[model samples]
Target chain A: MKILVVEDEKQIADFVKKGLTEQGFLVELCDHGDEAMERILDQPYDAIVLDIMLPGRDGLSILKQFRKKGHTTPVILLTARSELDERIEGLNTGADDYLTKPFYVEELTARLHAVLRRSSDEQMSLLQAGDVSVNVLTREVKRRGESVRLTAREFSLLEYLMRSPGRVYTRTQILEHVWGYDFDPNTNLVDVHIQRLRKKVSPDKENPVIETIRGVGYRVCKDGAE
Target chain B: MTPRSFRTRVLLVSVAVSGLVLLGFAWWSWQLLEAFSSLSGLDTELVAGHAWLASHLDAVRWFRREFLFLFALGLVCVLGGSWLLAWYAVRPVDLLIDAAEGITAQDLERRIPQRGAGDEFGRLIDVFNDMLERLEVSFNHATRFSADAAHELKTPLTILQGQLDQALQEAPDGSPLQQNLGRLLEEVQRLKVIIRRLLLLSLADAGRIRVALTPMRLDELLGQVIEDVEILAPELRVIQELEEDAWVDADEALLQQAIQNLVNNAIKYNIDGGKIRFQLFRHEENLRFAIANTSEGIPEEDRRQVFRRFYRADPAHSRKVDGVGLGLSLAREIVRAHQGKLWLADAPEGWVMFVMELPEGAGDGAVESGE
Candidate 1:
């Protein structure tokens, strides 16, 4: 997949670009909105991570212009502000997703994947964790190329966990992402689901694919070899 | 009139009138003595004696005794009257001096009572009172404004420093610098918010708060907001319980701005990917909009001050959220201008809920008065 990162800070942009490239994604870095706009218009990008702050034209204006011109490619906004109103404005201005700065690179990569997968009509989407692959198109799970049976909700939760590896996912984030806004008020639903999923996916292993963060949330390591 | 003041004025006027009468009497007595000496019948010797009073003691004895006695009596009366006059004049002046001397910065509540003299002294007292009134007003506004501003500025500046320090201490040089840059940007954003709020409040105070009240549906506005924020953090569950077709008469831009602020506050202070429960319903004579997010409950003491300009409950949240603490304040002001009320309520599950109630036709006209 090809991604364009438009950020003003050269170092951050370079760091993000190098990380994504190492993860097998073609990455292009641009500092200004004008340059990013030119590249976006000329070439098709699978995803575009747009920073809200730029020198010439701000990210919001760029997003607006792109939306006006009917460019519907998935756009992730990297904003220094975690303000609710600014985030709302960014999203209303046609950004597909928004991330606050001081974020983990791995987290950004996961969100980028989620946004792209949801926005695009492509099937055969696969997210890999340690010795595990969760397929979106087939709704199937494979551990070391062995097929595993999982419930629908289990598969959905596993997919979310697999997308972002070595990053913490709070209980609230898990609740919102998995059960959405309307869910039962059980405190241990997440723990129960994780245990059930582990039973099916990581049999005969002391440490499972999902690792519990004490007093916090859950994490899975990147690079299935681990 | 107090009996003392009236008695003092009466005594002063009476004493001056008596002193003038005494002087007239003294002059009359001397004239009478001269006329008696000038009488024609067998008065040649007497007239000569009176004219040469120093030469003939027998002829001038009667004249000297009677006229001298009368002159002494008049002199005594004049002295007594003048003493009374001076006493009355100086008494009020002394009172004024004592009152003025007692006034100080610590006790602004003191007021000079109009002592019923109804003279220039009374007018002076009134002027002094008016001066104190103006001083109190300006002093209040200036102090409150500075306190709020200082509090607002300090948070962002402190945040910027904290983030930079954390970066230096914890993360690698490159990663932490990036984080520091992010925090610096946040501080700048907070400064902008504070300035905007301050300007708006001043404009409101100056009676220049202009409003373009329009008919707008609350549901649609919130729906758009939900749609927008959902894209920003798809992981966050924002449930909207908007009453459809609920209309309000308000300044369209300002109302939207207020809602945006409240939602932003909710999102910023909320736990990561926490549930944001939004509700819109009409209460008696007002439309209510409420947003609740799971938060560490605000202290009771801080609850009242939360709407005060530049007030923050937690330093960590204040630093991370990048707000200058004016969002809620501005929102409260806008609501008040619209003849509405804004308040914070304790929510279930240790959440903080911000509730805004807007009257149907508030701010349709200019806000009646600021205070």
Candidate 2:
């Protein structure tokens, strides 16, 4: 995937560019706002990482202008301020997603992939991890082709993990996505639910589909039951 | 002597001055009455010219009676007029006292209303409002500085965390270097958390808190919190008695942060393998949530100081615990923003309990008038 990163700070821009480059994406970096706008108008890229507080132009205006011109490329916003108005405004101005600063690049990568996948034509109706499958529309969970009954909360947890198998999610991320919490409670809430989920789905503690990365968090296997 | 109110002081001064004027008038009038009596004799000699002027004596006696009546009326007038003067002097002072007492640190923008006094009182109000203006400016400056510093700090933190995370991924699995990198990454994450929290606090300090309120079941949220606590501290005995349909319109994330901070404190200060109990119920128009745990006792003096920013009851043991001493303060701020009250409750001996009282269905509003 080709991506463009526009940030004024040299170190941050370089770090992000290098990270995205190492992740096998063609990343074009721009430091100045006018120059970034010039490049954005010149060509097409899969995604753009635009910083809100840029020198030449603020991210919101750029987004507004870009959207006004009718460009449909998926763009993710990076902002230093966690102000709600800015987040809502950015979303209203055609941003696919928003990430607050002080975030890990892996998180950015994950969000980028998620945004790209969402913008693609193929919409995911069913998500699967080996024998366990969750139909997003019907809200059904099946283990080994057998329909498994689960609580609404448990179903949401399973669906979130199954959507991005093999991608480890931190507890904070899980809390934010699954629990719809904007702030981290620093509790082992994800662990408790995942345990109950493991019992009902895999039932085998030794070869569970949900894997725990110690000192990290939880993830589902990309392919399981080997 | 008991301290008098400003109104009382002004009234006393006015009464004293008026009383002294009334006494001086009475003394001068008594002397004038005596002089008028002497004038009756002179009038009889100059005008009547008759050796027999007994009627002049009777007229003088009548004048003495009328003079006494007039003096009595003057005394009554002086009393009433003095009371009115006292009231006039005290009214503005009473208003100034009420307005001054109502002012809080959060509302430096508030000014005493002008009543066209054009006196010392008005100047006092103007001076007071000017001082408030300066205070607001300085306060805004301080808040903006911290917010700016926190904002600037994020880029560096993001780079550090991003690079460290990347290096950790490149290192071999289970290698010592990777483990070290993981530790470094955690520290970076901690820094990120501190900065985020600091920014939030700065917003709250500036009374610019933004919150999106939604109606949700408090019982359900508490159940989830307790479930997490059970996972983390399995050794501790936990009990929860939550009422059904205990709902509140609040910002979920903010309320959760407040509750989690309280629970974390309960666990942190608790004795090893101690018991914790949580209660949720509706009282009147408020929903009450009480969480208690068996803990090392707090001194009587320290109990009041617990909610103070960066207050640690036992400084020596603070290091043994992992916290930045902002948990309770932040929790309290969040609760206050929700128009709720959170306080350290008077618990049974050997227990530390916190009581959170929130109105059952408060509408969405800024945190402590912030934002």
- State which candidate has the highest DockQ: 2
Which candidate leads the pack in TM-score?
2
TM-score against native, each model: 0.39, 0.80
Which tens-of-lDDT digit does each residue in A94-196 have in candidate 1? 8888875544455577778778778876553877777788777788899989999986668888887876565455554565456542111224667877888
Off by more than 4 A, model 2: A1-5, A14-29, A34-49, A61-76, A82-97, A106-122, A135-139, A149-200, A203-208, A211-218, A222-226, B1-5, B30-99, B111-123, B314-321, B362-371
lDDT of 2: 0.77
Native interface contacts kept by each candidate, as a fraction:
0.00, 0.39
- Computed on C-alphas against the true complex, the DockQ of each candidate is 0.03, 0.36
Q: Residues B224-308, candidate 1, lDDT per residue (tens digit)?
A: 6675456444567888788777777766667777777777677666777687888989898778888888776777788889888
Residue range B1-371, candidate 2, lDDT tens digits: 22245546656676677778877887887787688668655785643554444556676577677876876776677667766766776666677778878877678778889887789978887887788789888987888898789888988887887777667666655567766776786567567767777787887887766666677789888998787678767789998999977878777877987887788778777889899999999889999999999988889889888887767877875643334666787888888878889998898899989999998974334232212
* Clashing residue pairs, backbone N/CA/C < 3 A, model 1: none
- In candidate 2, the residue pairs with backbone N, CA or C atoms under 3 Å apart (3 or more residues apart, or in different chains) clash, namely B207-B370, B208-B370, B208-B371, B209-B370
Tell me how many clashing residue pairs each candidate has. 0, 4
After superposing candidate 1, which stretches have Cα over 4 Å from the reference?
A61-72, A81-93, A124-159, A166-207, A213-217, A221-226, B1-303, B306-371
For lDDT, the strongest prediction is: 2
